[model samples]
Target: MNNYYQVSASYDDVGNILSITRRGLVPDANCFTPQEIDRMTLVYDTPSNRLLRVGDLAPTPYRPYGFKPGVSPSAEYVHDNNGNLTFDPHKGLMMQYNFLNLPTSIGAMSLTYDATGRKWKKDGEFGEVEYDNGVEYRDGVLEAIYAPDGRLVAEYPSGGNRSEGDISRFVAEYWHQDHLGNTRLAFADFNEDSFIEIKDNPSTGENELEITQESHYYPFGMGHMGHGMLLLLQRIGTCSMVLKEMKTWG
Candidate 1:
C-alpha cells in the first residue's frame, strides 16, 4: 500500500492459533463509520500457544491537528489529551465535559451527568451553531444516532428536532450490529409512538423530504454515498431501510 502497510496472517493447526500482523498505520477511512484498527498481532491460542511473531512495527506518532482529518479535509479539529473535543470545524466546543472528563453539554444543548459520569438529562438548544458529539447517550440509555460530520442525525421523538434536542420523551435507541459489532442501522421513535421514515406521497410518487424539506450534497459527499450504498443495505424497519437505501441513489 502507499502508506507502507501490509497485512499477513498465519494459522497453526497443531496449536490452533491464528496470528495477524500489520506494518504501518491505516487511518480511519471514514469519519462516521467504525474504525478499522491493526494495532497488535493477535495470537488466539485455542488449545496451545504455538503462534510466533518474528518482527515488530511501531506506530507513527499521533498528531491530531497536523494529521489529515478523516471527515473534513479543509479544516482541522482540536481535542484534548483525553480526546474530548474542544474545537470543531464548524461548531466550536463540540462537547463540554466536567472535571471527570465526561460530557456536560453538546454545543448549547445542556446535559446533566449522574455521579457515575452517566448523562441523565439533555436540554434543547436553538443556537445558530450546530453541534454533535458523535454520540447520543442520556439517562443511562443509548440512542439511534450517528454523525458523518460534526453534527448529529437521528430519529426525533415528539417535540424533538431532527437536528438538535437534549430531552426525549422516547425509548432508548436500539441497534442491530454486524458480526464485528458495527452498527449499520439506526431506528428512531417519532411522534405518537410512530416511527420516523421517508415515504412516497400516495397522491404523488415523489420522495418528499419529510414535507417542505430538501437535502443537497456536494460532489465529494456524493462520491461516498455512491459506494457506501452497497454497504448500507436494508438493515432495519418495514418500508424503512429499503426506501432510505434508494435515497442514496436519488
Candidate 2:
C-alpha cells in the first residue's frame, strides 16, 4: 500500500515558524486512519528573533512531553552575547567560540585553526585529526584525501601494503548528496565487482546495501537518530564544510 503523509506549519506575524504538524495515514484494522505522527513547536526571543525552544511551549520547567505534552523531551537553546550558541539542553554541554566566531571547543573536543582562519586541527574523544592541503590525518596517520569541492575522494588504510603503488593502496569512495548538499549516501566498491552489492542484514532483518554509510536528515539539516555516518564524515573533514554551508554549526 502507498504511504501517505502530510505536513503543515503555523507561522507567527514576524514570519517565524510557530509550529509544525505531521500526520500520516496508517492501517487501523480494516481501514486506514489519519494519525498525528509528530509535531514541533518553536519559541523564539521576540527581540532577537533567536530560537529559544523547540518542541516546547514555554521556557523554564520543561514540559514532560514537549509538543505532545507528555511524550517526548523538549530542547532548549541558549545563545551568548556574540550570538553564538553557547548551550543546548540536548547536547548537554557548553560551547566556546573564538574571537573570530569560530568554535573553539565543545565538551571534551577542541579545535584549532590556521592563520588564514581555516580549521586545521581537532582533538577529541574520538581522536586527533589534522587537515593539511586537502588531506586529512587521523592520530598522525594519513586518513583521507578530499576534492576541491570537499568531497571524500579517497581513503587510506593504516599499515596497508604500499609496494603496489598509491592508487592501489587507497580505497576510492563516492558521495551522493541531496539538493541541500547533505550527504545522503557514501559507498566504495570493495570487491571490485563494479556493482553495488545488496544483501539481507541479519541484525535489521531487512535488505541492506553494501555501502560505507548512509544518512538521513530532518528538514533543518539535523541528522536523524541512529545514523552514525556523521562521525565518519567528521573523520574525513567533510562534516565541517557541510555544516558551514548549511549554516547550522558554528
Candidate 3:
C-alpha cells in the first residue's frame, strides 16, 4: 500500500487540476517504489474538458504495471475524441467506448449498444466465443449467468448475453435500485463479499486503470462548487470529467 501525505497541485486558468504531485508517498516496507512515485500529470482539451493524456512520471522510472524488470517507463494513457481510452501502453490494455464514454470493449472483447443507446451485447474473443459467462439486462434490470463456451445463450433485451443452462459459475451477484449505486467498480462485483479489488501491489508495482482525478458537486453529475460541500461529486464510479457542471448554484 502507498500513502500520500503532502501534495502539490497545478491548475489551468479555468481551475481544472492539471497535475497533482504526491510527495511523501510511502509504500509498504517491501515496496519497489523508491519513495518517489511522484506525479500523475493529466492533459486535457480545455474546450471539451476531455482528458487527453495521463503521464505518470517520477524523476526517471521504468515501465509501470507488471511489465518485466528494467523496461523503460511509458506515458500513462492515450485517449480518443469520444473520451474512450484507446491505449494504455503500460499494460497493453486497449479499450473503446461509446459516444457516451461507456466502455464498449477492452482488448479483444467488444460491446454493442441498442438503438436506444443501451448496452446491447458483448462479444467474446474469436471462435472461442460461447455463451458460458455473460450478462443480460432488461428494462434496465441486469441479470447474469455463467456457463461454458459453445453452449447456446439467450440475448438480453437491453444488451449482452445471458445464461440458458445451469450456471457454471455463481448466480446473481446482487440486486439494487438504479439510482445512486456507489461502488467504485460500478457493477464489476455485484456481490459485496467478493467485490473485486484491483490493487497496485507494492512488492510488484503492478497497477491497473485507476481514477486519478475526482470532484464532488451540488447538482447531479455536474460540478457546482458554489452550491455546497461535495456538490461536485454525485457518486463513486461516475466519470465527472465528461459531466460538465450544469450551474454554479443548485
Best by lDDT: 2
CA displacement after TM-score superposition, residue 35 of candidate 1 (Å): 22
Superposed model 2: Cα runs more than 4 Å off: 1-6, 22-37, 56-76, 148-168, 198-209, 223-250
In model 3, the worst 10-residue window by lDDT is: 218-227
Give the residue spans of candidate 1 off by over 4 A: 1-76, 81-83, 126-175, 186-250
CA lDDT of 197 in candidate 1?
52
Summarize candidate 3's per-residue lDDT along 147-234 as a digit string, tens digits. 3221122334334344334233433322222345422122233233554444445676554423222333222232212112233344
Give the best candidate by TM-score: 2
**True lDDT of residue 239, candidate 1:** 46
Once model 3 is optimally superposed onto the true structure by TM-score, how far is the C-alpha of residue 148 displaced, in angstroms? 27
Q: What is the C-alpha RMSD of each candidate to the true structure, in Å?
A: 14.9, 12.6, 15.4
Which window of ten consecutive residues has the lowest lDDT sum in model 2? 58-67
lDDT of each: 0.42, 0.64, 0.47
Model 2 lDDT on a 0 to 1 scale: 0.64
What is the per-residue lDDT of model 2 for residues 70-184, given as tens digits with 9 covering 90 to 100?
Answer: 4324656789898999987655777999888898999889999866689999999879989998888778766778873334444334576423244334556777877777777
The estimated TM-scores of all candidates read: 0.30, 0.64, 0.40
* Better TM-score candidate (1, 2): 2
* Candidate 2 colliding pairs: 65-70, 65-71
